[model samples]
Target: MASNPPAPEAPFVPSQRSTEPFGSGSYRTDEGPWEEWNPTEESLRPVRGRHRVAKQRGGLARSSTVLGVGVIAAVSAGGMASANTGKPPVSISMPDLPSVGSLLSDDSADAAEAPTAPLSGIGVTSADTAQGTTDAGEALRTRIMAQAEQQQDQVDTKAAAASAAAAQKAVADAAAKAEKEAEAKAAAAKKKADEAAAQKAEAARLAELAKQYTLPTSSYTITSTFGQAGSMWSSGYHTGLDFAAPTGTLIKAIHSGTVTEAGWAGSYGYRTILTLDDGTELWFCHQSSISVSVGQKVATGDVIGRVGATGNVTGPHLHLEVHPGGSADGIDPMAWLQGKGLTP
Candidate 1:
């Protein structure tokens, strides 16, 4: 659809045979043609309407204009193909046409004087025509590359967020685990400290109670224990602890108490009953003599009586009984003495 300017024509040269004067009615040509020259208005009239020329195909005309146009078309097509396929443009070579500039007639020379039109459409600038790159195609490629870059950036941002969240979660989990371990250690230490404190308090309480109590007698040996199964007394079992000793062995008040009974009768001879402040009673039975009288308050370790074999006795010993709250049934005297921090 596009073309180049036509080439200039060569100068005209008349043959030697056609050199006769213009007044003659005949003319001579190298081809032996004779023609009469007449100047008339009808013969010189300009042609009207469009004149169609036959199209040349299969081969190019031996004209420099045609060759230039073919070369331009081939180069344009190659550039377009290279741009589309992202490949280099192929080189195009024009065939040599000998004496092509001299072959043009006067009509071609006139056409060569006309202005040449652009190969592309209107509004195409000289800068746009370089490298055969169209405005529309370049714009499309630019937009596509920009979109691809944007999508890649979005993917990278999401990946970074996920990684940060995972790291934060790991830190939180570790902190929680450490806190739990610390709490457990603190609790264990507190429990151990409480147990040690309890043992120290118990020891201090026993030492204070030892100051408030004393043993009933010294230089004595245990002959019978409470709860022994034997036919030794009126009761079916022994209800008192027997301390065997030499006669006249002094017995002392077991604790700070008032003497509730002395000079007892019947099975208990010379028996002395000492009542403690808490209404618990200590009975010293089978004594050799009674030194405490009823209603007399005595301190701990004060002499109360002596050991002897009296009524319902088997040998020279003192029978001791303990009655909590003055109850008729008595508990084991050895256990009560140990409760007061006394081993015997």
Candidate 2:
């Protein structure tokens, strides 16, 4: 190859003076005898001194490119950083720079002209871009707040529903309890009404029976009740009701009956037994005299005997006993008379 046109002359650059002392064999001026120099860690170590860097043709453009790249990186990561850290967003500052096309081209004239734009206008553009980032962050925060509010509303709605359900359940339970209570009260009232009606009917029946029955003796005072315990009675208990009256007080038939017996008895003295149509025997014992003979058919209230103390030797009275179907065992005469609607 032809010798490269003669290596171009290097451009002149002024050198800065150092304040450090020179080595023993070193020269301070350019015209001195030169010595070889070697750099070492000790020599290269930084010292406390004012230092200055000389500006080069494209230095400002390179610095602007580096700062712009850093600003973009911070902007891109801003949202995520704020979200992750849960901290306030920090402001990013962007310095003025040459235009994008000027930075990419090697044309010195374009680079020089790019920075000539008004700084205020460039500042406004940078401010707008920063504001956009700030707005984006604000929007994210608002969306998060809105989501939180929505979640809270959901919780409140569910709670309200549960409360309403509980209230309704309580109301239903109360209604059921009240219904049961009402039923119980109604049943009790109905039972009471039925019992009262039954009692009324019983009273009317007894009234009708009284017409077909009569007392065994009139104007007689009751002296003893049936089933009275006493040593004087042969069976250790008095088996009949005693009606006391003057001697010869006429005893009447208790109902329409036929005389089954009329004669003297051992301890009973004179006795008369009337057998009713239903086969119930009424005994009029301790009588002074019996007016009816055996087999005599008698109507209700007909005279059958007279009060007496014929044998047992007590005051004058009619001892009355009742036997169902003429059975040997006698029942309470007082109760039997009551059943026939005869008080005496």
Candidate 3:
């Protein structure tokens, strides 16, 4: 009976999850916040399309940049190798890259239509392969630069040599020209001096001849010349020239001679024959007085006799005759005197 009475009215115990609402004093509302939740991939599908293309473009640009870096590293390595080997670098040609326009284009349809081959298929591959290509390119650049520098040096050397040669040639030419001018001047001066000397010598010779010779008389007129046509002499023609002058007029020796004869002849009165150095004889006939004796030497212009009317003369005159080689026949005295530079 007591146990039946114990279970009576067991205390009003609340359930594990209370169904009653909190009190207003705790600052709660009937519409409380829900539990925190995490979203899944499917639940975020609405925003995927907006950013997908941008992501793809960014990835392409990053890949291209990485390829460029690899190439640069390879080039640096090759340059170092050539410097150590002391050999010329190799040459490399790079393929054309995509332009900015092609890279920035967003037309997927166009990209699909073009359908270019991958980098590996077109002879470019991993980072190692790019490095090797870049190394070859660097070697080529080094070779080109070296060749250019060598060519420039050679050109400069040649220019310098040519300039030096030209200068030397100019100097030589100028020296040669100066020498030739000096020689020509000397020759001209010498020739002029020689000509002046010759002229002076000829003048002196003429003066000497004038001093050594004189006329037979001071003032006389030629009346008859040698070879004149007439019977005035024993021969067929006049054999001596007649110089008409006043009686006692002085007669002189024409040139230096020795008196060979000073005696009278049948047709000559007080005649004198003078023999010269060349065996030529000069005869002075019909003289008033004979001062020079036989075998006497007389100089030119010496008073030998005087003019008078003697044999072979018509009046007070002197007959003169010139014989070459002491011959009988006489030549014209006027012509013979002119041959000795005398204007008789």
Candidate 4:
């Protein structure tokens, strides 16, 4: 028991670590994994040649990204490494962290550290500071006044819009009413014009009737002429034209006139006298019967008496005579008939 079985065989120990950081946490190394010693600069040269540290980022975007992140980190980190000699193998702290204002120029530091001005338009006041709040009180008053004015302006704008709309509606309605009135006036004028035209046409028709008239007893051929030498005339010449016809031949007025006499005359015998508006008188002598009475309104072609062989007529004939006034006077009956549109 004291001999302990001649000391069991010792377990094998692994070789010591090399000097490379990947192998033994050191930067200088030349041996394989089994080497247990550090290396000098000459011995580590080959390992240094075998690997490389990249000089710059690959693309511009990558470079920019790296540069931006590095710059931001360095500015904010506020500490620098004190030694690069690889002694102690750890980073050492620098004493001073430069303030952003001290590290940059006055312009850059002001741009970076300056508090932004407040947004302007509605709440701005004349003063820029607010230590005692005197300016702040005035600014608050101004803002409240501006807000009230804005509310009043909104109400005024709505009222103006309503008024304008009402005015436009009224104008449109007035235009429509005026158009309707114009149409009605045009229609009325057209109707009145049509009536005037009809009245004119009727007057023209009556005038045409008066233009074409003659004594009905005339056969257009005078059997005896007035002023011709004849025994039947009381003034030594024929006092009237003799138009021979049947005893009951119809008689007609020479023109538009009024009957002045329709009774027996001393010499004319069953006579009717017509007086024209121009004061000219016409006598129908030796009428078998009178068809129109005295004072009767007679137009052209109206019957006044009949043809008969009475008075001084020797046979069935009409004794027609003219009287300038009412006295028995003689005139050419043919010429007088032509004046009344009677064509012989």
Candidate 5:
């Protein structure tokens, strides 16, 4: 603008930085950016021989700290690993090695010292680490085994309790079943006894009823009986009882009843029927004489007829027949008489 700003005054230029080293008596500057520097004869002269010696000492100090710390760490790691795995430690060699106790001693001056001897001179054995690891491993194994035993004992106790409960339940069930069976047996026995007692009571009642009746005739020979096979009668088998006697022998009533029938019954000859109150008819057949009339009442042992050789008679005898409800077929007269308490 104004004559091109008077030909821009020459750009500001700074002096070149000099990299010459300081005097030997001066402290060095190591914190700054590096620059190419040239040493002076005065600065190099003082450190020429002693410098290498100091560096060697420093390296030894560093190695002692590293080796001491590494050995402790390796030992500790090996012991822990061995204890966990239940195995021996891996072999690691340390030359001219002192005891760990001495190396780790609280004295700072002693820990600063390094092993001065060569690698093949002395060392710690692998057996030392193995011994320590074995002791720790055994302790751990004992603890584990103890815990396992305790758990097994607990399981056994629980199992025993359960078994006892099961046994008790089985016993109770068996007892209940037995009790039910016993009750059933008792009921069956009681039922059988009651049935027997009822039968005995019925027999006693029938026996007392027998005492009230008597036989129809006496002092006569039993020539024939009911159900006897004979061609002398018309009905295949004898249907009445025959008491043989002389003609005009007396016949009597077996029980007290009215005379519902008293007349000649054809093949029955002269017959007299005495019907008891219970509708049982007593027939006196082949009679020589009839002494009772129809509608006449009679008593037990009353004479109703006499023995004679009447119609259908093989001999002079009294034929007695029993007809329940006045039906044609009659039962055995001898059994009927016995049932009526007479043993003819």
Candidate 6:
């Protein structure tokens, strides 16, 4: 009751805020209840050349540019390093024009300079960089060592080849020399053999000549005497005497006389003649072989001929004929042999 509480004051009118979107990126606030809250020209208008980019995006772009610059610097450094360290130089030329020349910048001016910073954070100076020159010297030494090794290999191979060739040539020469020596030895042997053959042939010819003329080589008992009226010869005479002996018997000469005849005769085959110093002649007929030659002097007991039945005889006998002073007519051979004390 407090009088109906001031009769419900006129439905309490509260002040209303201006209707606007919550953020700038919104629907059309000017045509809606948010028109009064719309931004004015000063608020909506951007600075003439301002792009209104995000702070982080601008920073990212700057960082990307920096990284690109670093990459370019690294590439240039690598190129300069290659040029100084025995690599082929980079050449650039213009298209459709003469070849261009090169320009030396700071990098080319300090061509022999070494890097001051090490990978492990060591540093050096321009003139003091010579202290780091040990690596370059080592590289140079390695290249020289490789070249020397290659040269040595080539030399060794050539020397080995030459040695092998010399050995082969020596072998060939030795073989040829041995062959020549063998041939010479063979030829000498053949010559010696031929000379031996000639000597034997000469000896044989002399032996044959001795056989042609022979004298009685032995004394024997004369059973049927020669040149007498006896049993064998058809001319009513015996031309030779018979002596008994075994085969392979030894015989000797009658007297020391020169042989005048030997070998076969017409009536008395295998006959021999001996001429004495007094020109007296003695004949021995029917012999195997004569051991004396023509004009050969003989002594008693010398082997003049072997007894054999080669003449006209009925048995193995010695056919003898004697002549005084080489006369054609023969004398009694028995008397002649008896005079010489040869019983035949």
- Each candidate structure's TM-score, on Cα atoms with residue i matched to residue i, is 0.46, 0.55, 0.41, 0.38, 0.46, 0.34
Report how far residue 249 has shifted in candidate 5, in Å. Answer: 4.5
Please report the TM-score between candidate 5 and the true structure: 0.46
* Per-residue C-alpha lDDT of model 4 across residues 1-344, encoded as one tens digit per residue: 47556877654244545344643556555423331333334544332221111222234466556556755665434222112222222222221321222222245434454333322222223453453266678889999999999999999999999999999999999999999999999999999999999878856764574475665655535678767885666778877777888888899888888998899887678988889887888888888999998789998888887888667657877887877666555577767765554544
Q: 1-344, model 3: which lDDT tens digit per residue? A: 45444456543343333243443445344422222223344544342211111123335577477557756765665565454432333433333434222333465643554332333333233764677778889999999999999999999999999999999999999999999999999999999999999878867876787788877886778788878888767787888778888999999998898999997876788899989999999999898888989999999989988887777667898888999999877899878876665765
State model 1's lDDT: 0.74
lDDT per prediction?
Answer: 0.74, 0.74, 0.72, 0.65, 0.72, 0.59
Q: How far in Å is the alpha carbon of 138 misplaced in model 5?
A: 13
- Superposition TM-score, candidate 2 onto the true structure: 0.55
Please give, for residues 50-79, the per-residue lDDT of candidate 5 as tens digits: 110011233556656766788788888777
RMSD of each: 18.9, 15.6, 21.8, 21.2, 16.2, 22.6
TM-score of 3: 0.41
CA displacement after TM-score superposition, residue 64 of candidate 6 (Å): 99
Deviation (Å) of 106 in candidate 2:
13
**What would the per-residue lDDT of candidate 1 be over residues 195-312, giving only the tens digit for each residue?**
8898778667766887878888889899899999887678889999998999999999988999989996678887999999999999999988999899999998999999998889
Better of 3 and 6 by lDDT: 3
Which ranges in model 6 have alpha carbons more than 4 Å from their true place?
1-219, 239-242
Superposed model 3: Cα runs more than 4 Å off: 1-204
The ten-residue window of minimal lDDT in model 5 covers 47-56
What's the distance in Å from true for residue 191, model 3? 17
Instruction: Judging by TM-score against the true structure, name the best candidate.
Output: 2
User: Which wins on lDDT, candidate 3 or candidate 4?
Assistant: 3
